[model samples]
Target: MQQVKAGGLPAVSTNLDAPKTRLWGERRFRKAAGSALLLCALLLLVSLPFALIGPSVERLVVLVLINVAAVVGLNIYTGNSGILTVGHVGFFAVGAYTTALLTTPPEIKADSLRHLPAFLANSNMGLGESLLIVAVISLVFGVLTGLPLSRLRETSAIVSTFGLLVIVNFVLKGATNITNGTKGIYGVPELVNLPTAYIFVFATIAVAFAYKVSRLGLQLRAFQDNEVAATSSAINPNRRLLEAWALSAVVLGLCGALFAHVIGAFQPHDFYLTLTFELIAMLVVGGKRSISGAVIGTLLITALVEIVKPIESGGGIAGISFPPIWGLTQILLSLMILVVMYKAPAGIMGSRELSLSMFKRPRLSESTIDVASLRAVESRSERPAATLATNAIGIDFGGVRALNDVSIKVETGKIVGLIGPNGAGKTTLINNLTGVHQPTRGQVILDGQEIVGWPSSRIARAGLGRTFQNIRLFSEMTVLENVVSSALARGHLATGVESYALSLLEHFDLAKLADTKSSALPYGAQRRLEITRALALEPRFLLLDEPAAGMNPKETASLIEAILSIREKFALGILIVEHDLHLIMRLCDEVYVLNKGEMIASGSAEKVQNDPKVIEAYLGSQEVRAARRKKTT
Candidate 1:
């Protein structure tokens, strides 16, 4: 449902939403994901029938696969958490040496053990056991070291990991008895044949899939999107970061084991900074957010490298008998870099992933509607306007003065309004009630207990939702994406979001512009979008802050009507702050007037309008009205 205006840049990022669906829809997305998975498996099976074209080409493929696995693993930490870590190379080396030490042949192990420690010397195994042990042990190592270190700032995390890499290399170099002191290990068994290596690719893909759907991914993503907002949601950023870092390391460790067995001879020199940078480049060029992007990037870079290898002479173009150009390979790659930089810098796949929906390519049934956000809305029959206040309350903020404390007591909802001039703190009070702002003192009492100073997200969980005075729609994101993102934040990101969003859009008669980028909407539409997003949260108490900010008279009339319609549909207590007196007077069941940051009067709209203080502050008083009357007489 994402929509971009003509010639506007598409964000081109894939975001996975919440989980809920009818059995039929669940079956459909699952079928699509299953088919894509099956097709990829078939291609692998078909490709494995032949031996690699050349040993050089085979090596290139193996290295590319290793790099792809490592890159994908690194993304678990780097992509979702928004940290740039260079320490992944350290984990790669740890995995590499772990496999090498465990899988070397008995004779080679003994011969190399002149100065070895007892445990390592006696521990070498056959290929399968070594690979499995390497994966598990490296995961443990990652959790032990990487988790604790991940709590540091991004730069610090990278530097610390790099230090670990240096330390590991030094240890391997110094301990000739163990790790052969960097002379390198030889005679390691080759268990990863062509087909077995492809199997390793499947392992990495599985890891990617699990990581994407897990709770760790969600916490990390929330942290990446907005750390401040994430904190407000009570996600333990440090813990999530550590878990992702550790998990990524363990998955990369499996790739390292594959690397060790494939080549048979290995050295610490193989996993240096150069290899790390190349791995990062693959990720950047491929599109970081997606595992498939990592796979594609790995393939492209590997193929390019193969083409640049030295061709034995006697290769003459047009019988010139010309020799290969020195570093022509480097020059060619450099030119490709320039072209790619000049073109799509977001990489081949951008941030998009292979999704469950893309395979079926379902055109929305509600073509003009978002159709993805139905769970974010509520129905009117369950909620009536007059009885609204029993479920929802309002907040007032100003140094414990209790500016105004009231809850809608009616069983059927009624439209209640608060009217105040600038600086009257109506907006401040609204923020407190809706959990937007923590009060210096006051309970957002629901069911008679204090829900004071709760985070906006928690308050939102409690079903008191509000909108900002200035629109807070995801500006760069399209209209549907904006709403979808909000729903995901509310923990309802999947199939239900589409159904509810679609239904809500149709109900509000905004179906036609569903695909439009929200930022491009006209002022009135943007206002409506704010309300729509709020309604998406399915709140019982809806606090609207100046929903009529920039509308013309016609637009205002339409907006008022829309508000009334939304009220009936949602069956909620409605509290709004507005400068438009006539509309407020007409729509609000009761009005509260405030001046100088304190509530001064409360009554039915007619009585409040006639109150002396209200007249003096907003309408300029009786004497002023009398003077105008006399002038007219």
Candidate 2:
């Protein structure tokens, strides 16, 4: 039980943190994983009878497995990677058609495909052998499809897939000599029996389960949610998408082969645009990123179809039931998918893995922080004389030296102002200082740690936090969600972690906007929300970049008061970048003037205001000359 350190906690030693463990310790993961397996087994046991007892029910169950495999595979693309792919069924069609040709007997093929090509003409094989052959062959086809289709993005890709589906169908239709044309190929040796089919189904589930916990899956999910953030986190968007594309194609290809072997028939018309939509619906209904959601959704639709089947009246006369109307079930499924999309885009568990406790109450506990621990953290902050020289170090960008080696030193608790005219490079210096952009050449030392060239995220984690010049809140999200997202990013967006985001918002006086959409927020409120987001990271040094940019004079004054209070209360070193001179004069402990990307002067507000260069570059040389002329007159 050696100590482990992660997220401020003591991390365990290498020997104690063995590969046997996952996110948690080995014991916790084992318990959680064991419970998950038990739950899956229980569900399978419960669903087995429905799949075995009746002919129609059994048929639908088998179909469900096939669809589940496809849907689960598709999640790798749509669910985790957040990309839309509609041409997936093209691979399915290829697999189905391929399996039919490979497994069909010569005699049946001769009759069925008297017009078939010579290569496909005398195909014959045992059921097991044919399935094995189709699985391998379909996978090759999947790779071929994925390789070229992955080059496009979003809407272009969607439209591109439609083009592919049409082309594939037309090609299959024209390949009468090989694919038996659109008339259909038959006699596929129906090897997908109940036992064999379920084995394949379970195997597919295992693959999906394994994938969800794998590094690939994590990368896919990260890419889908935030491409920039994911890139910073070392996840490549295009590569991850293509990997998902290839993997999903392979799995769907397996499903296609199984379906072809099960029904012993196929045609170009069977897998067209309509089939593609159905596949998308299955994925959406089950929740995009979860394998269990896909499985559950598949089973639900399958069972619904069976329930709506026409009752030939094993005939008890309470009444006779009829099969659902044309496309009735599909319409219902479509409605269900639409509802889930609006109500909970993350699906039942979002990307959360399923476990036996799906129906159980969760257990929880809390620990108390000792007073000494709090004081230990506070004691680290020294008084004015002993404190680190906290200051806005000079930052320069390409060609224009934005900061001209400007520096500031903080004594105890103080608010500093960084005022410069537009185009004076205030934002540029902030960018370089905050790790958003690297300095052409300079260093940012914090608590004896040199943080130059570090990524913005790493710098932020190192106790330097800042707000953006523009309110870069996640607009589509709620206000609280915006802050919560920041918290999640701070720790890689783990589930079940409490977002003290709301607490920060409350402290900043924006709690009333928690449920409101960020984009809908007014200007003043938006600014506060942005500050609240940065504060959620618990930074030791906070940089405010033009916080009063859009505020009225009254609002600006109120914000200045709030800023001063924050410095005193947190004992935090603060720097403000603003063009509002009144706020700068009153707020900054010391003022630095920047003109055309160079520091003209630095001193107390009154002293810098009187400097000749500062007056010449900023206020107007004419005014200074007039004052001199007046003195002579």
Candidate 3:
């Protein structure tokens, strides 16, 4: 069971049960389409009953659908990208104003926007034409605003977006000739009715669902869970976040355009904080992670608003009136949000999409890749070997040197061991080789290309994959997803990733638990999963940091066997940083020992084991030990 944190977002358990989508198949597309249609039908059913009551009720239903479109758009960014934004309604305002100015009659435009630029001043567009323009403009706006904020931490992103909100509101309020300031624009053509709203709402639902299962969406969620692991998988976090933000903006823009027409007229205040707060409340209360949650929250809250407004105005059911209750809707919403924060932080549905999990059929997806086909690729004649070499590479943190004049090389189809006592700079050297740390004074050459200062993601794409000293898994994701997401780094290879990931799982003896959440896996399995995920990058040289750190002798033996098979099958060069001297001595072809951030010995494992300097580093000098013992006595 997932626990909700104080802020209403689920804790570590949030991603434990995310729906797994089968990549590139009719079955997957069919399921998604069926789910969307089912949701649309439910909305129609709810709205139709209210239509028989009166036109006001029908209009209310239309408004609710528009809000659903807006919140679903917001979920694309705030939910998947894990950024809280108060500025989407700013895009809504942009859409509303853009549509109103473009679609209004030339006579109205001349009066209201006399100072408008010639290009915008003369054109009179229909609702459809105006909406098309609004979508493009909002996307551009989202990209521009989201790009700079993409790399920021959560608090910074929130502050930047809130500032964006203020800037947009300022523009709308001050651009009097165009937006007519606080007086608002009048005569926005009423082009959206119940039928039109229904069409757009369903369209939004379909698009959102499609995006949720897309490669981009999966990568975004991976970044959300663990940025470092995502980067190691060759996923560029900032670019993916920008894509989500822009796509969500397009949806919000479309909704805003629809809302403007439905209301027949609107002001800046109509799309300001009031609207922003309401939309955010809906997303949070419904659950930020699911599209269905967005729809449900919008419907429930819209009904609450309607119900409370009548009570606030002293209207009653069947002629039983009561005193006016000011801000009752807002008060009730606040209470509901508080309750949700404590009780069901993941919102109503958590990470689950609308599905048949309740029917108790098999949950695990069987491997679809032919084992023979995978083995055939693995058995092909080995390609030309690649090499990773560092020459006198050094890095300093402030005044302390983490790695000093460290040089190392690993050729394809070999295993090299990095061994040192505590603070001996083994991991630091690995970081330099893998582009995590820029060498202060030397060169990192991969396949003869100088990669000393490249970003980690670029280096990863250049055929370098590494695991962390501490196991870093996409804990909320299934084991299969962890591998498949990494495989997607190959671009067009995404469709075939599921099979490849399954093959990797099978190699590591994790085939049966492929559908299990990574967090739920046994310790050994999680470690194996991390290695499998790294291998998904298909790197020419793989770096394993403390792979056998906590493993028992039996588990280490299995790991050693797996490493041997991987080397023979893929012809990969492996660099392992481990304290398990026995496993290292058995598995590594060559061993390098470090003392005081300097390489002190390098040779065959047997030679290094007997080297006098290596022994001195491991067990302090005789004179030093004698002095220490004398002091203790």
Candidate 4:
């Protein structure tokens, strides 16, 4: 046993190699390999039936596979970022038109597109060459579109992307030389057969699955859950969204190119509103969050279309005659979407991945954090003493001042408390320090560098960690994932992140619940999980807002112990904005009081407790108190 010092506490025996052992002991590689093999097998099984049904049925299967690829591409962005984009079909259109122009013969181009540039008019390429060119073009479009799209959120993003689709359609329709002016491109080579379709679909599935399980995917999902919490953990939401957007654009473009080769011809309308609705319906119906959902939804919706198409054309099925319905397929699809939304809003699979774990017995072993692992994590790095201070900071929202001339300081290895009645601006001050709000005046300094205008992610990376007043855990993610997300944002490698996150979880006694969904945890556990998540950043300063708000005495005691241990072991500054005065007095070395956005008193807990001004702020002024007493009498 190796002895290690914990803050100013007695030395304890620790195992320094425990974390290293756990680091290398992760089973992700083996699991990923196994899952990949399983996915390949599943794809083969699905294709076997369609392959045996002859050429005509095989064609339908290929089309279905193409649609599956498109939906998966859309999911890569919308699913992870929780941002709805209707403009992906624009990339699809670009790919299809670009492919047609490249693969069409020079004579055909010369006849139909008289005004085409010399290079385009003379150029004719093979399927492989055309697809390569199409990918590059799509990537350029992705970056150009993503630059603005990534910065918008919700309705704005959705509306802007729809505008992108409209613009692309208008361009394709008006550009006579490039797209033949909506008379539609023809003479595209038929290069995508059943086997080629299978290959592309399999590749798409593999890419989506791999990305969904990657660190970037986890960070994006965290941002999807809560933007503020994600940024505070140092995850750049816009960067992640932009990355997803670019990748999704490339995938959608490739799918469109493959569709062109399959169909042999297409008009601009083929990749317009109708196609956009169909692809989005597939993703939404299947569950936008999972790769499996995209495949399942595509298959289901494709089958429905196939079954209804004949009836929609006034043809009989199984000797039953039906009237021709011009838009029957769309109507049925709309109805199905309505039913699915009402019954299962998250789609069929929700956020779950299809896995082989169901075939195996549950493991009975517990994952405990030993003392040695704790010491190893604590000793992983050294942190120097630092101060976080807000100097004469003032914040105004609209015409109202939220925080005026609020100045405070916290030094490493010290616990400072901020307490006041409701609307005292404690949280607002924390927000200012953590970069959630910019002060209208004054400066926030960390180790002598002012960082008032920086984004929350940058401030977090500058060694400030914070827990939200509302306890904004990534509700859909697992407890382990929440911690790992913060570590990943802090630049931890995927291979070693599990061990690092697990060490922090163990410190907070949350290791046993690591596999549980964060929203499923008890209220107290959720609070602790938020703190553990913040700790994963290895921050020099931690700002905790209302950590003890809903905790019971036991939980509060445990939290106090954890806080003290963290301050000792990590040598970090802690600023706690808590309403629990007893807990504040017990843990905080110094206290600051605020009244109506202004700092009124600051001193040791005992000194502030007896201050007349502090009492008046909490209760009332002398005259007001006297008036109240007279009224009561």
Candidate 5:
């Protein structure tokens, strides 16, 4: 690969670097279109045999396809965001009721005791128009339901969704006039035939697959894996989750409308817990992480359910006498789900997407350092240097002072270190600066504007980024993906982002492992990757907590070099916490010493290192202690 120099460092030449292979846009559209056509062909092929057999078999195929659409919708949220959602059925119910109310003949609606709003009660539309209305209604319900739940912790989030389902169920049963109550709505026209079902299923698959590889999908998965890191990278967890939930809900609603038509009748009980359980089981058994998993799980469980229904009805199978068995399908499905959970917790697909890329290695050019190009990219940020300062910041945790009147300043193009023994509250100070902890008695000023109580995410978006003491790379993602996700944190996902991410990777000597999963990288590489990910935020001030903690001497040296190089390239103000004094002394322009939650010393590295008080803190010199006692007396 050719190399070009931009900022005194050699970077990979633009011509020599391989073009980005994003699974979206033209290439992705082509693949999805092809997949859709292939799916259509397969559905047709599958339908022919059933069609020849009889209309009953063909109808079963159509129902199975509709189920696939619903499952795919559930998978979009559950698989991508790692949130187990049971409320999608609520959206489905909304879609079905909306479609049924609008499309039902006026005579039937009048006889059913119509009490819907005047517009809805009087309206009767074609199947296409009804479905369009369903889409709109579903999206609204999805957003409304998802907003509060998306902000909750995992278990609470799932539990809150149960409440949504219950509310929808109650509403459907209670609203006798509009829904015809528990008795069900009849005379719903069967608009979705096998061909239409095939089209809908194909469309669902296309959307799901596209979403799984979209930028939003990447951010959601990253948020799922590491919330703190994702936040620091400017990924908004609640917002991403809500988006996924809404999209999933809309798709599920469409499925529900189609299902309503297929059955020619429905009740409040149709879209409830049992259907929710079936969808969840399919997702878990087939693997919630991939479209293929959703499709496979849906087909397998659906087939089993169909087979068991006949046995439950006392139909003898292959000379085996069958007797009536209430809830046999539910029992068998439950057992199968339990078995899959025990045998394979990740389900059959695990976290892998079905992609042709998996069959062939990514085509990347031989790795080369592009220090200049990387630096060149940063040179675009010629805005005024940022100034971050804390004025007498202090916080008390249950009356124990974690930080007492601590104040420090980090200006652009400077490296500052906070060093002390393990309990000296070094990290606490960083936390206060980053808005992870709101200082009780001080101002955290960025460019002279106080931001002490701002949320961590807002602080990050305000041009401050941080890395944890323990490496927090989005471990489930590839090295490049981890950085690219960060780069897109500010909502820019243009094609240029890929090159910038690669340049950062190249600068850190990580481009060679661009496609390697972050979890699979060596510890040192993971640490560097974490730094690279943080840097992708384009922060004016970067806070690094114990960045050199687990590094060997060589790794420390390399890290120190990278820190210095990146600082210069980006004109960043850096606040670092490192136990390696030698590396710190080499890298930091100024250093602050803390002891027992107080700043003991602060100045140039040489001045602080030699101060008697500094010496006392590290080595406990008796002379220094005695001198301190004398001064106190």
Candidate 6:
């Protein structure tokens, strides 16, 4: 292994073998192999009963597997992005129609799709060629829809996607030449069967699972948990959401192709609201976050539907005859969804995967500090000093000025303190600096480049990192994942990232709880983890908003030590917005005090402490301050 020195730290190995890299690879491979095996076993277990049962049961299994494939695709986007999509079935319809038009005999297309263009009407492609074409078309649609959808959040995004579905449904019904209108295209080749459906199910499961564990998915999930925090850590929410959206579109398209081949004929209504609701219910009930959940939920819902479907058709149970109940299955399914939502909002698997570890006790081991990896990170941080400064920044909320003429500068290796009482606009100033809010006027210069109006992700990538006053950890993720996601967002090499994250966790004494979910951590630990996550960005300047807010005396003292150590080790410029005067007095090289959105005092800590304006702002009224000062003297 080649070694390179980093400042006063020991030499870091730049070779692949440095710091348990090989061991990590082996563990990762084992886990992946184990998961793959488990999936195969599950497929076999599910197929066993259907295989032994009559052909009728076998057909139902095939349909269930296909539904599972479609729902898994939906989960890839909706589950990770936390953006519920009502339009995915539109992509499914696209796949079904595209494949149907392509693979259908040219004669059939000529009669049914008389208005279709010559190319599609004459096309008589095989299943493979049809599917490839479907994938490309689905990708185009995914990108087009995702561009607008990714920019929205919550109800707006959801409603926008539903609009997409309505538009697609309308297009399908109106475009008679292309889609055969409401009658739909027929004579699609029956190329998918039990084994064929199983193949696609396996592929879908693998893809969804891979995405769930990939860095991009981690960043998306982080954004889902806390948008401001993720963006501050350099995660581009739109890009991640778009990627997942496109991928899921392709998967859903393939599932539609499989469905077309299975049914051999279909109408536009086949892929409309009925199918959309069924797939969504399957995903929600199973657990939207896990591939295992998708499969489990599909199977459970399919069984329920099968059992209830007989009664809906007027079939007697136990030889007891009853009147047919129209929409009985739909009513029951709706009730089941309501119960699941109220009882288990996260679904069956929540954010967890079904793995071999679930069947066995996890072996806990102390994480050893990887010195070489730590040094590698330190080497990356070594750079010329840069300044992050705001020049006469002003912010307005309607007629109210939140901040006016606020200017602050932080250098590469100094700790600057920003202090103010409640509603003094301290946090607002930090917000402008971090790109959470654009200032009405003034410039933010980073290393001499004007960066006002830049996105938070861009600001973070430009080497500025920050923490929120209220903790914003990816609560659903593990402590280690929270840090690793930030590192990955900053483009850290995947091979070395785990070791680097472990080193940071060790620095904060959080390595032992690395596997624990961040939400499970105590308040102080969550605060430290936020700092650790920001440090993973390897930023030149860090903006910490109230890091000492809720820490007890001991935690605050430890936080001071950690902050000081970080500044010395990484040569970082730290701007801390804190109400904790003791921390400011102990750690700040310079203090800037704000009162009523304006800079009231700027000097050493002692000077600011004694400033009359600062005293009056905190204690209220000139008379009261003077009275207290006279009595003290």
Worst 10-residue lDDT window, candidate 1: 4-13
TM-score of each: 0.67, 0.60, 0.90, 0.93, 0.90, 0.93
In model 5, the runs with Cα more than 4 Å from the true position are 1-48, 114-121, 356-383, 398-400, 491-493, 620-633
Q: How does each model score on lDDT?
A: 0.64, 0.64, 0.81, 0.85, 0.80, 0.84
Winning candidate number (lDDT) = 4
Mark the 10 consecutive residues where model 6 has the least summed lDDT.
Answer: 4-13
Give the Å error, residue 449, model 2: 25
- Candidate 2 on 270-362: residue-level lDDT in tens? 888667877787677767766667766666666655554433213222575454366665667678777888998867656545665556443
For model 3, which pairs clash?
none
Off by over 4 Å in 4: 1-40, 357-375, 378-382, 623-633
Assess candidate 2 and give its lDDT: 0.64
Model 2: how far is 464 from its true place, Å? 16
Question: Against the true structure, candidate 1 has what lDDT?
Answer: 0.64
lDDT of 6: 0.84
Task: Give the distance in Å from residue 173's predicted Cα in candidate 2 to where it truly belongs.
Answer: 1.9
TM-score of 1: 0.67
Question: Candidate 2: misplaced stretches above 4 Å?
Answer: 1-39, 115-119, 126-141, 147-151, 309-325, 358-633
- After best superposition, candidate 4 residue 275: deviation in angstroms? 0.7
In model 5, what lDDT does residue 631 have? 94
Tens digit of per-residue lDDT, candidate 4, span 378-442: 34225578999989999999989999998999999999999999999999999999899999999
Q: Tell me the tens digit of each residue's lDDT in model 5 across 1-633.
A: 223232222221233234442322344457556655555565566556775688888788888888888988888898888889887888888888888888877878787756767876678799999888889888888888788888987889889899899999999999887888899898888888888988898888888877866788888989878887787788888898989999998999999899888887899999898898998888889888877778778878987998899899888889899889988988998999889889988887677655555455534334433333343332523558779998898999998999998889999999999999888999889888887788989789998888977877788888898989878888777787898888777554555566667767776777777767788787888888888888878788999999988888999887888888777667789999988899788999999999999999999999999998888888788977788788999
Candidate 1 residue spans exceeding 4 A from truth:
1-51, 76-83, 110-119, 126-187, 206-247, 265-269, 303-342, 353-456, 473-506, 509-540, 545-633
Stretches of candidate 6 off by over 4 Å are: 1-19, 22-33, 359-382, 625-633
